[model samples]
Structure formats: C-alpha cells, structure tokens
Target: MTPGLLVQSQGRVLPVGLSVLSTRGKRELELPDRGLVVGAVRPGSPAARAALRPGTREEAFRGGVIVLGGDVITAADRQLVDAFEDLQSVLIDRKEGDPVTLTVVRGGQTRTVQLTLDASAFRVQGR
Candidate 1:
C-alpha cells in the first residue's frame, strides 16, 4: 500500500519514523547544517504524515543547550536530551502505543508536538 494509505489506516506514529543520518554524516557530505539529516521517510510513517521533509536538520533546543549549526530538539516528553543518541536510546526503550512529546526548532521557531508510537511492518535495523 502507499505510505499515505497506510498512515490513514493507522494513526500518528513515533520515533519520528524517518530514516536519518547523523549530524557528522551531514557535515561529511558537506550538507547544510550539522544536525541529524532526515534522509528517507517511510510511507505511512508518522514522520511522513507529519511532513518531516528529507534534508531537514533535526535539532533539539532549550535555554542552556547550544546547537551550533542546526535546529534544536529541546525535549522528548519531559525528558531532556543531551545528544541525538540520548533521544534514540529513549525511543528504543519505548513500545508501540506509547506517547511522546517533542520540542523542536524549525525556521528559528520552536514548536511542541505530540506523537504516538505505531507498529511498523519492518523493525528498525541495528537498534
């Protein structure tokens, strides 16, 4: 089925449900900013449904944390992430149907979004 169709049948998915590259990879590729770069988004995935675009920098932001050249990801739920791995580790521990709150900086503006984890047909590799 098409990704969109799958999402319609399901609901908001989590872990942002997108294929991402590390910020270091982004820099090596000479891409824009040094942040997690969204590479591909699964069809019917929450990331796809949420309109997270490929090539966008993933950043976590808050008052005391400084992200040099990328967007800031402030928090996930009530937990603050010191690094990308911190966020990934937390998501890894969560199960489908769990809820997550994400604070992100996009276009120099901050937005808080809520998402629900969904079961994917394929498991995330190398988790």
Candidate 2:
C-alpha cells in the first residue's frame, strides 16, 4: 500500500490531525531529539483530545540517554510500530474515535497515553 499522510475512515480520506516533525528537524528547532517533537497539534483533534501537546517529545530513555524515537508507537488495536509511516499506515485503516496507546517520553520520564483518532481536511505542514 502507498504510504501517505491521509487515512481512509468511514469511506472518506481524512487527515490524522497530528503535526509531527522528524528528529532531524527537531535539531534545527533547538529541541533535543529526545523523540519526534509534536511541532503542532490541530485544535480539538484526536491528538489534542488525547492531551498530546505541540512541544511534546516522544522517545525512550535509559540511564539518562535517548535510545529511540518514532519507533515506539503501540496501539491497543495494532501491532508494534517501527517507523512513523507504520504508525500512519495503521491510522489510515482505523475509524475515527478508535482508541490507541502511545508510549512517550516527557520531562525525562516515560509515560503511556491513550488517544482517540480525529478526522480533518488535508494539511501539508506540521506547523
């Protein structure tokens, strides 16, 4: 299947409503690539409803060192996520309001969060 930013839900292609920046882009923003920094989150979107903030960084740390980013997405309804594309791929097939579990690193601590998907028009940029 082709990888893209849009997902099919309820017979319509919709945006997942998350603004994710790559780890490399994070470096340019002066934020350590602790994880993929959520550059911007659509207001009232699934991610926003899930309490995911724009500056939130999703990563895993051990012994005070970053081990990985964009590689730890695990939804309750899906398998392990190896990349951002994998995560998006899963989202595409799921309906809005589907529940997902995310393991993220924030404030030097690892936390598990639950999220629901939201549908929106297409957006090309994270910010």
Candidate 3:
C-alpha cells in the first residue's frame, strides 16, 4: 500500500497500525512534537571539543545542569523549537563564532547552557 494510504489506515485497521517507511524501509519519524534542532559541529570548535554534536536533547534540571544530546537542539531564549529547520533559521541570524546562552528542556527539566558557535562548522546532516 502507498505510504499516505497506510498512514491514514494506521491505528484504524490494526492495533499498532501501519507505519510509513523511508526509502531504506525504516520507519521515518520526527524528533520532538515541539523543540529545537541542532545541525552540526565544526572541527576544532568549542562545542565539538565539549562533546556537543547533533541530535542532542536539551532539558532543564533541578540543579541547573545543561545536557547536550550530542547535537539535538530543543530551545532558544526559552522559545520552543518545533523543528530542526526552524531552529537552524534562528541560529543563522547569529554569527558562527558567537556564544549564545541556550535554555534546554530535557526529561521534564530545564537547564541553561553556554553554546559557542563554530564559525567554520556547517551542517552535514540532521536527524
């Protein structure tokens, strides 16, 4: 069946329902129902050196600890990131080498992080 048709029939025809598959036959899905997207890390960049990459989920903690899910971005200036593309747009407005304070929400908690942009880094791919 077509993916669109399958999606429409999902949960209706079966208990688990049908799921759309990607070109490789893997099920495609979105990261956050609403949150940020982290694109890439620049070589020799502070973020990279700090072990921050893409697909990192940012969440706040009771102790104010910021956790980086490699590169999954979740929020900016307290603004909820619904998609990665949208978050990228906002990041683009700033310089690559600039350091910005990011508020991350993860695991039902919130934490702030100091993210330093790597001016030399560009997005190779995103989740």
Candidate 4:
C-alpha cells in the first residue's frame, strides 16, 4: 500500500486534499459581493493602516428602482473585471505589498487608482 492511490476507510476511498470543514454552527454574514465585499477595514491593519475600502458602485438605479448593492469593480490594470472571481484570481498570482491599480465604480462614477496588496483576512490568524 506504499504506492496506493487511496486509503479506504469504511469502504470509501479517501480523497486527496480532503479536510473536514464546519458549515454548520457558522454564522454566515451575507456581504454585498457574496461576502467578498470589504465592509470595514481594521485599524492599523494592512488595508486600513494603508487606506482602502470597498470601491463604490457605479451605474445608477436608472430610476428610483435599484438592484445589486455591492461595489462594481471595473478593471485591474486595464483589464475588465466583472465578477468577484476575477478579482480573486488576480490576487492569487500576486503577493503582499505588490502595487496595483484598481478601477472601481461608486455612485455611478468610475475611478482608476493604485493600491498596495495586503494579506487577506482569511490568511491572517490570531496568535
């Protein structure tokens, strides 16, 4: 079994990269962008300590009616970013402290600018 492709327990082959996760008993707080929206920046953290917030959303209600509330991310270095995964994919290839320009839409206005990357909230852990 040294070169075995799997280890079976109770007749079930254990999958690679398998780990137990608790979706139960977890308080799921819904944020604007599938909980990926940056609501509040921690003081003295890489973001707040630096200066970044959830980019504002552009594209007005087109009337009194409205739709999604999350900030609309327009672009990353001239590349269009239309979804949350797009932003995540870009960040994955980057490292902390890397400088980047993000085009954000807020209140129907679009602005392009740069920001330094920081460790995501998920990566930072309490001692």
TM-scores for all candidates: the values are 0.48, 0.48, 0.44, 0.45
Which wins on lDDT, candidate 1 or candidate 3?
1
Candidate 4 ranges with C-alpha deviation above 4 Å: 1-70, 121-127
What is the C-alpha lDDT profile of model 1 across 1-127, one tens digit per residue? 0111001114432232112434674355343332233434567775555554443332432211112333345566757654455567668878887877766555556677666667761265321
Cα lDDT, all candidates: 0.45, 0.45, 0.41, 0.40
Q: What CA RMSD would candidate 3 show? A: 13.3
TM-score quality measure for candidate 2: 0.48
Candidate 1 lowest-lDDT run of ten: 1-10
Residue 62 lDDT in candidate 2: 22
For each of the candidates, give the backbone clash count: 11, 0, 19, 4
Lowest-sum lDDT 10-residue window in model 3: 1-10
Candidate 2, residues 29-62, lDDT tens digits: the string is: 3333333334345676666677764543424222
Q: Give the poorly placed runs of model 2, Cα more than 4 Å off.
A: 1-35, 56-82, 121-127
What are the runs in model 1 whose C-alpha is more than 4 Å off?
1-39, 56-72
Worst 10 residues of 4 by lDDT: 17-26
What is the TM-score of candidate 1?
0.48
In Å, residue 26's CA in model 4 sits off its true spot by 31
